[model samples]
Target: MSALPASRDDASPLSARAGLRVALPIVVLIAAIVAWDLVVRLNQIPPYVLPGPLLVASTLIQDWPVLFGSLLTTLWTTLEGFVAAAVGGIALALLFNQSRLLEYSLFPYAVVLQVTPVIAIAPLLLIYLPQETAVIVCAWIVAFFPVLSNTTLGLNSVDRNLTGLFRLYGASRWQTLLRLKLPAALPYILGGLRIAGGLSLIGAVVAEIAAGSAGAGSGLAYRIAESGYRLNIPRMFAALLLLSTAGIVIYLLLALLSHLLLRRWHESALGKDN
Candidate 1:
């Protein structure tokens, strides 16, 4: 009889664990897909109006070559823009960190660039610049601000006690920045990178939309627009799915990188079990 209550207690936690481990997520995912499929099928939605997952998958397989090629192009453009933003933004942040006068003088301009809608400026950029250059520039502009802003904040937010200690130790300005400030700011920098990665993808797509087709350098966004123009709804949805997947992958990658880099020392990186 005593063993019965003990077994029940043990079984309760195991049952809850099993639900969390397997049942809950599977149920939620199935429910979502079922609801989506039902809404599409039961509502008599035309494929053009809202292609079902099956139709989208069929489209993906059928147009694999075209869709994959466009995916590669968009990925390349996003990476290029993100790389440029990382280098330029970090440099600018460092410069601003070193000079309050310059920060005050130039920050408003950065804010203006950040606040200005890429859609508004993309057309002008396309008109004024070569096609490939315009797309890259527009993407760079869209992604640059987050890294700049986050890194600057991080650099400025070094612990006051640590700063005082470093100063007391006769650490020079450059030494303090390199040994203390930059390390302290890394988490913030990584956070900015996550934001910039998504923005880079958006910027590349938006720039392509504004620039339209110019020779063979078009990305996924161009394919999306072209597909829509030709009423290739399934293909459009397929391209959209690829874009969404890419964005998710990029975010996961950055999160993984952040965790790996910070896991040893940072509280944010610690797993809940720890």
Candidate 2:
């Protein structure tokens, strides 16, 4: 038999193509920012209504301490909530995967929790718990469902052939889960993580908006509200820009982590041939 040619996985053409793909978005972002700055400058818009990028940048530079402190608080809260959600969601997903009866009984409750509005629940949580705890709980509620749903799907998606192989090997349930199902589910869990990362930040901000900030625990959302009330438009825009940047950073970080983890073996982590 004749041998076929090798596949081009690491050639210059492939690397250059990937570089171009990455460069395209960055170029678009720079163009958009430039266009936005030009439009604001040409229109001579009032800072109170629509601050130019320069004004927002100046405000951010001037209020670095206050804004950075608030950003840290928000980031901390989101990280706490997201971590808790990731752990709890995976645990619950495993439990649900163990039995169809349990899944039927518990899955609806999870859906109900997910459907309940965080804004509506935040007030009640605040009344019942400490402010920080309330905020964390609210954030967890908002972020948990995606992880739960995605992880559950991953766990259940094991191939029947694999399941039979594990059974033939006399694998215990736990052994099968640890060695087979969990590995298979990693991409799905990471997918949920990417989504939950953004949701966690949003949840923290929304809870802060609904419940208001307590001393020593205020976040960027509180700063935004404070700026709006005081008519500090430039400062508000600065806070908003920080929040947007943080969200984007969180998403990109999770995506990169997912790609790194999957790149060794997963098809989804690799590019397709044209």
Candidate 2 vs. true structure, TM-score = 0.90
Candidate 2's C-alpha lDDT? 0.90
Cα lDDT tens digits, model 2, 7-95, are 47765565666677899899998998898899888998788998888889999999999999999999999999999899989988998
lDDT at 144 for candidate 1?
94
Q: State the lDDT of candidate 1 residue by residue for 131-196, as single tens digits.
A: 788888888999999999999999989999999999999999989989999999999999999999
Predictions in order: lDDT: 0.89, 0.90
Question: Would you estimate the TM-scores of all the predictions?
Answer: 0.88, 0.90
Worst 10 residues of 2 by lDDT: 1-10
Using lDDT as the measure, which candidate wins? 2
What is the overall TM-score of model 1 with all chains considered together? Answer: 0.88
